[model samples]
Target: MVDRLGPRYASTLGWLFATMVSMLFVYRPPLSLLMLFLWKVVGLLPRAVPPVVIARKYRDARASVLSAFNAALTLISLAGPTIIGIVASTDPALPSILRATTLLIPIVII
Candidate 1:
């Protein structure tokens, strides 16, 4: 299945699998730290890739709009964790919700 998708998508799927499996072992401190690092690296990927990809794939006015959109998304992505952390900390009931949402982050990104 992976071979059919080519390298980028295949590696993405592999990373997702590794991250999900890592979460199962997260009760162990060292394993949890490793998983956290993996998740962090994966989380940064979209910010690193999208603007350049868009710029390369388009030109002139369309490229400008795509670049702007990509920039906004990157900024939002960077801010998302901080915002979620603040909300989780300030509201007692929100931590569980945030945790549930964040579970997908590790799997999808890492």
Candidate 2:
């Protein structure tokens, strides 16, 4: 699949599948077989594709490019949370928005 579609595309699809599964959480479904089904399905997605695709994509990349990519990722990761934290810390309603995003982290860890 990676060879045919390319690592970038395959990785995108992997993350997309994970995101689609995660969207189910917004419904606040009751604890039942369905909730278990969603959790188990979401867990499978990143394990299935992301690590291999990401590792393969970067393994052969030049050191300079990888360094730049890492720096960019670090900047974005830090900046987003810092900005959101600042907003949520000051605003009452913003915390819910930040809390909503908490659902995304588990799948991302996978």
lDDT of each: 0.47, 0.47
Q: Give the number of the best model, judged by TM-score.
A: 2
> How much is the lDDT of residue 30 in candidate 2?
30
TM-score of structure candidate 1: 0.26
Off by over 4 Å in 2: 28-110
- Write the residue-wise lDDT of candidate 2 on 24-54 in tens digits: 4433323446444544444454555777775
Model 1: clashing residue pairs?
none
TM-score of each: 0.26, 0.28
